[model samples]
Target: MTDRAGHRKAAVWGAGGWVVGVLGVLVALPLAARDRLPDRLATHWDASGGPDSSMPFWAATFVPALIWVAMAAAVVLVQWRARKSAGGAAPGWVGATLGFGGATLLGAQASIVRANLDHTDWREAGSVTVWVVVTLAAAVAVGAAALWAGHRARVTVPPVAGPTMEIPEGQRFVWLSRTSNPWLHVTAAVTGVVAVGASAASVGGLTGAEAVLLAGPLALATVVVLCCASVQARVSEKGLDVTFGPLGWPARRWAAEDIASARVETRTAAQVGGWGYRLNGLGTTVMLRGGECLVIRTVKGKDFAVSVDDAERGAALLNSLIGQRSRG
Candidate 1:
């Protein structure tokens, strides 16, 4: 790498470190001013901007801070991995993703703190509807700008393993394999259960406007969790189809005609920059646990790889299918 490129990368890494530090500061800010906060902090707000749920001062203040810290830590970890990745932060979006994480989390929590801090009486609650919307919008704008900038960075495609087998033209075959990471499901389930409990607990005393506010978000979160649980991959004459368990069809499908080549590529957390639906300088990938994956290069030159068992046979069948279309 050139000296200039090395310096630029170092800058990205430094920025990532700063982001972590900033998040820590954000978490500390509310705790520092605890004396002014109400005995019960308004942790959950409804659409009408009223506090729908609250908790004792210390718990409310520290709990969200802990969760935010965890969330920040995760982003920094991913950013660190991406920086250490080949092509000098090829995932480019690392900065943007990190930015979004920091902004969204800190911004939201700051609003919550504001709502509680201004309460004139302990029993009275403050509205945070505007805060929620404004903070989220600001976070998104910052993330988008960061994302666009990250995309401008050089794109890098990792090396792929050469083909080991071929399929004959006369024979026709179908290839299908399904793989799921139990850990992913467990994580999703735990998250869903926690969300349900929290949602129920927060709105227990809420009614009408306040209840509706939390209800929409809780419902949306359940759906998102269900979608993130598992993935399924299928290859046929039509082409490759990958579908998330909850959202079947329409989300992901690549036509056979659009495919340029398919091969069994070795899988590593480093190569895809860690698992679970990843997008790096390489094309999008649905990678579960590490192993070998059938990587497909589309005619447009975009690559899509899925890490699964028995990738060799799957790759061979996909190649054969592509070749058959080429000849016919």
Candidate 2:
């Protein structure tokens, strides 16, 4: 399936699972509490059937579930409207999905506990509600602050709009600004999110549940390794910056003068050998699935290569610029 389809499918599955989980909780609560609470309390009263039961089933579960339903509805509405609009505004579904989906899972767990366990009184439920509200409010505040800061810090970066071949004269340093493939950008974004999320989830203290967090890190590391394929060589007047691990920023730089020659080439997974940045007997390796390479020969008689998308065009551009530099 296409990546977009996959993302949509995952979202649908998550929502579906949440609905199923809610039903499971509803079914299990009655069974789990039958022997523990009186018949009136167990069947007619709150799910727990407790004394001084100030809150009813509808009061706790009904309200939250309705809120979840409303949020989901809003997500659909916003996305539909966004589709009719121009210029890709960050989708409202992003926030709605993250917020409602997360809240549903958490809120459901709290609901189940309150319904099944007598220890979880209305006071505890109130506390949980307060905590959730406070946390949500704090998150909004922080997000607003971050948006303001980002806007304040934002600076316009003009495209490299001039002649493709002409290297600006006497330019001590110039950062390459080029539009990469949209698919690549999407892939990078997904890989980065998975890697970062897994890393965070891997940390202890998240939950007492015996979740093997190490799996997150391992999965993150693997995705990071694969995402390194997108980084095109970054050209500067002094040197070229090539990525090492993941589709993140490059960590290695090779001087322009050190480069003996640059050419466009292709390689298979075998030719690349190993992951991460590997200096094989061939050249500097950036991507594992080698299709196009920007091969560079360092001054030390070692050739380094970075596998980039549209490497031939990139090589030509670099060659033109570098050649211009040599002449001037």
Candidate 3:
């Protein structure tokens, strides 16, 4: 689309989305007011022990709707500004705004449902789960819509040179593209799914047996994610890119020359203080849990770390790579 056309389209969508959102809020406002009513005034069944007669439907509706309105307004504003940028920038912002707004609305609904449902009772077995599914689906839909809209607004073309690996001296940057692994990505995705499920179940007051069953999946996923991920690293001429999340890049990089020394470091969860890739207060990082890691100290004494199956071997490989590059 032309810049003017794209701008106009974005503006229309933004305005319409905001309008719909405002309507939703107006519809929901009555739910929130339910909390204000005396106990005897509540006509709906209160067996769930939800906040008594005060449970106003309008208030419940309004809170989420209000949030959506704000998000929609932001989206419109971004769309208006995008006309001048005339490229992919405006689309990105609009899509992000839409996705963010949708998420806020979904979150508001979730909060309300969570407050009303007693998932621990098992009597509400399907209720909370259904709401959870809806919320997740809605969030995904919003994100997908944003992505689609953003794509529509931009010209589609692959980069002529892709990403560069030319790291200049004194610059603290690393590039890792050649080492993207499909297996590691799969493992991370599985881990996240398990973790989220377990956490959700536990949150619903599933203590003792139920909690164990729910939390068990999460624990297992966490362990598997950490264990399977410890050996992988993304390496390029620029630097090493570490992997943590399932679907995308979850690493930070550093320059080769800045790395003054290289070594393998072994650490436990307690010593490293938990799992995944983390930069702690001491400007140090521990990748994964109970694994060997390639630890490189920068000239500034900061650590650039990556998890690899053979830490020493990885460190040696890194050293050799750096040496070759420097000599060349």
Best by lDDT: 1
Tens-digit lDDT string for candidate 3 (51-126) = 3332344455455566667667776676667755765255555665566455545443534443444333312322
Provide the global lDDT of candidate 2 against the true structure.
Answer: 0.46
What are the candidates' C-alpha RMSDs? 15.2, 8.5, 14.4
What stretches of model 3 exceed 4 Å from their correct place? 1-232, 277-283
lDDT of 2 by residue, 1-328 (tens): 3323333443344334434444444333334443432222211233343333444544443444555566556766676677568342335334435444543444343433433344333433222343345446644653453344223212222324454546557654344321122333344445434433332222211322333454465456545543453343566666677643222344578766666567777766587775446667776666544466677766687877765544564465567666775776
Question: How many clashes in candidate 2?
Answer: 3
State the displacement of the C-alpha of residue 321, model 2, in Å, after optimal TM-score superposition: 3.4
Ranking by lDDT: 1, 3, 2
Reference-based TM-score, model 2: 0.51
Error of 3 at 71 (Å): 33
Badly placed stretches (over 4 Å) of model 1 are: 1-173, 206-222, 246-250
TM-score of 1: 0.45
At residue 225, candidate 3 shows an lDDT of 56
lDDT of each: 0.61, 0.46, 0.48
What shift in Å separates residue 112 of candidate 1 from its native position after superposition? 30
Q: Candidate 1 — number of clashing residue pairs?
A: 1
